[model samples]
Target: MIGLTTYLERAQTGVWDLPAAFLPHAYFDAVVRAGGIAVLLPPQAVDDRVADRVLDTLDGLIVTGGKDVDPARYGAPAHPETDEPRRDRDAWEDALLRRAIDRELPFLGICRGAQVLNVALGGSLHQHLPELVGDRRYQLGGGAYSSAAVAVTPDTLLADVLEATPSLDVPVYHHQAIDRVADGLVVTATTADGVIEAVELPTVPFGIAVQWHPEVDSNDLRLFAALVDEAARYSAEHTARHSSRTRHPEPAR
Candidate 1:
């Protein structure tokens, strides 16, 4: 099973405003395309016990893209360009990543998910990209994707999955990006503009995060497939461990 994170949004179905958990179908499509069961995990209060109990049941996790991570988390004031705070989602996902480190669970972070992943690892964000780049090469329009080529570090997990010299014209949309990468993670790819595009934790079997939305791209499902493939292995190993424990029951007094 794969757990995909979702956020709360206002959906107008009737004449009243109601908060609802929502996510794009592409997320579920990506998971299913990779031969895994897709389950959307809604944003909730920060409860470690609840997080652990729920997470322990899933083989992998995909932190979906959404609102910006409150700059307060990385010790920065909110930038005027930053989106409204999604504190509940931020706290929820942060807690999940914190627990993920110990479980050695597979994680694939996308867009805002990438930012949260970095912050959860004690890293910081730029808060706003336009200020640093001095141009809008990362995101073309307001929230639409702008195509750019990314140079992959040879022999890295990203390079292996991409299986080519450079990733060509991947969809990108963001105003904030990774600043000081977590010491635990290594840079795997970057754009010609020197912006961080991908990262992975060497300590874990599969801890990968990308700044762009791979799930949004209908042409390539490599990133999602890689995650699900690793997740399947995790599920198999976990089941085997459980079976062994059940067969060799602890002796009763």
Candidate 2:
């Protein structure tokens, strides 16, 4: 099963108000097309045990994009444009990400998810792109997507999955970006402006994070397919181990 993170939204589910765990259908649809069962994992208490329990059940994890990671996390002063951090999500995803790394679960992080992955691994973000880039070329307008021409770095997981495409058109939507990449991550793709569009961990068989919402494209299922393939292998191995343990019970002293 592939576990996906969700956002809390308020709605009138009843006579009164209510906050519901909400996730975009695109995430679920992408996972389904990639040959994996999708499960929505709402944020729980900031406990290691809780995080581990959730991570243990899933073969892979996809941290969806959302509000900015708390600036306090990386000890950076929040820029005027930076939105206030969602404390609940920060606590939950922080624990979830740390545990996922510990467990080595196949991880695919989206835009903000990509940022969270970087921060979780001791990296940082640019916070605001317009000031750094001097223009809004990457972002077109609100509720719309800008197209970016991406250059994939060879000898990386991204190129391997996309078959070394010299250039590819991808939907872009983000102001914050990876500033200092994490320790084990290698840059796999970028735009002409050199913004980090995709990254992967050399330590894992399938640990990838992309700034573009690959899940947004119905045709480009390569990224999700790669993750699902890795997740399937993980699930099979996990099931085999469980069966072996059950068959050969440990002797009590």
Instruction: Give me the overall lDDT of model 1.
Output: 0.87
Residues 45-96, model 1: lDDT tens digits: 7788988987898999999898889989989888898888989999999988
Those runs of model 1 whose alpha carbons end farther than 4 Å from true positions after fitting are 14-16
Let me know the TM-score candidate 2 reaches against the reference structure. 0.94
Clashing pairs in 2: none
Q: Tens digits of per-residue lDDT for model 2 on 174-194?
A: 889999998988888888888
Candidate 2: residue 22 lDDT (0-100):
84
- Stretch of 10 with least lDDT, candidate 1: 161-170
